[model samples]
Target: MREWLGWLDHIESVEDSLNNIKARIKAFADNGGYPESFAIIYNGEIAGTVGFNDVNKFNRIGVVGYWLGEKFQGNGIMTKAFESLIEYGFRELGLNRIEVSAAIDNKKSRALPEKLGFTQEGERRQAEWLYDRFVDHAFYGLLAEEWHSDNRED
Candidate 1:
């Protein structure tokens, strides 16, 4: 985990919310009162992780967060990985809605939710801080009903 965290810091474009890198991994493993974390691996290396940030059981809604290291940018790896994760969210987790957000300047990230047909709900100006700077984040969502209808076959 230190390797990944150090890579994030070195990139200068990536920011993580933990003082201790292993602590973050432990918390994710423990779930802190949430569900499991999913990893999409490629060639036996850590590709990335995508999982629920907020999963409301009563409402059956989940917010997913994903991050890919700088070295693996592009090549459509994240898209292929995310499709499987999203499918698991809707099918296995039985979630009604899956939400994703990206910094407005992150053109690479904005494409993920868009390609998946998520509805853009506008930007949150100065909503979050990253690398000592504030950034606008664009919110998006996809409902299970829409997923089923859009991807189903006759």
Candidate 2:
């Protein structure tokens, strides 16, 4: 968890974890669901999370974020989750553009957007501070028209 998600390293206890979860929920509500989140359930257990963060209704844009437990990888769980999320962002939230960014070296995270038909935009140098070091981000974006055209059943 600490490898990619450095925040987990700060959670020293179960209480801390609970508090973090609470804070996230509060932020979601406070922002009018701009950072809407969803838990990925696998075999009746929470396997991960997928969400749209940094949502801007005025600009009709949102950034996608997600993480899956090590035990849950390679099961196609995130792929399905993101598919639904992208649909929700466009169809329900009326978003015109959605973006995704992942550590340049984190292939699994970066692959989600690519496999979902998101176009690779560019890389942000030292975009995130992960624990003791910075990591570059590979940015990708998908537009509403692109999604609709690709998904339309002709």
Candidate 3:
């Protein structure tokens, strides 16, 4: 996890990783607290993580966040991972909406939501604080109906 600091500015130490694991466990058990995180595997090797963040059960909404290792990117893996996640969110979790946001400058990360048919809503200025400075984020949203329309099998 330390090696991913370049792209994952949120992780700073071993303690952070341990704490994150604990939080993920708690989230999975609690069902509505923190984001439920999962390890993304590629060919049986750990590749990254994709999860539903800020889940609001009452509103049936959640935010999506993910990170992929540099070597694991560019193969349409994350896009497919997110596609399946969105389907699960709506079909199994009964969520009505899911949102994603990326730093405006992080074009690669920002592209996944767009590729998944998430509508570009707008930008949130300085919505995130990286290691050194604050960065603006571009927010995107997708409705369950929109997803079903695009992805449902006949």
Highest lDDT scorer = 2
- Tens-place lDDT digits, model 3, residues 52-133: 8688889999898888888998899888888778877887788999999888888888889988889999999988767677
TM-score of each: 0.75, 0.89, 0.87
Candidate 1 segments whose C-alpha is farther than 4 A from its true place = 1-35, 152-154
Worst 10 residues of 3 by lDDT: 1-10
Candidate 1: clashing residue pairs, number: 0
Candidate that beats the other on lDDT, 2 or 3, i.e. the better one: 2
Native-to-model Cα distance after best TM-score fit, residue 13 in candidate 1, in Å = 20
Residue 90 displacement in candidate 2 (angstroms): 0.6
- Output the better candidate (2/3) by TM-score: 2
- Is candidate 1 or 3 superior in TM-score? 3
Clashes of each: 0, 0, 0
Residue 63 CA displacement from its true place in model 2, Å: 0.9
Note the residue pairs that clash in candidate 1.
none
- lDDT by residue (tens digit), candidate 2, 1-154: 6688867777899999899789888977887765578889999999999987678889999888899999999989999999989888998888999999999999888888999899999999999999889999999999999998995642
Q: Indicate the TM-score of model 3.
A: 0.87
- Top candidate by TM-score: 2
Candidate 2 RMSD to the correct structure: 2.1
C-alpha lDDT (0 to 100) for residue 97 of candidate 3: 95
Candidate 1 TM-score versus the reference = 0.75
Model 1: lDDT of residue 110: 82
| Global local distance difference test of model 2 | 0.89
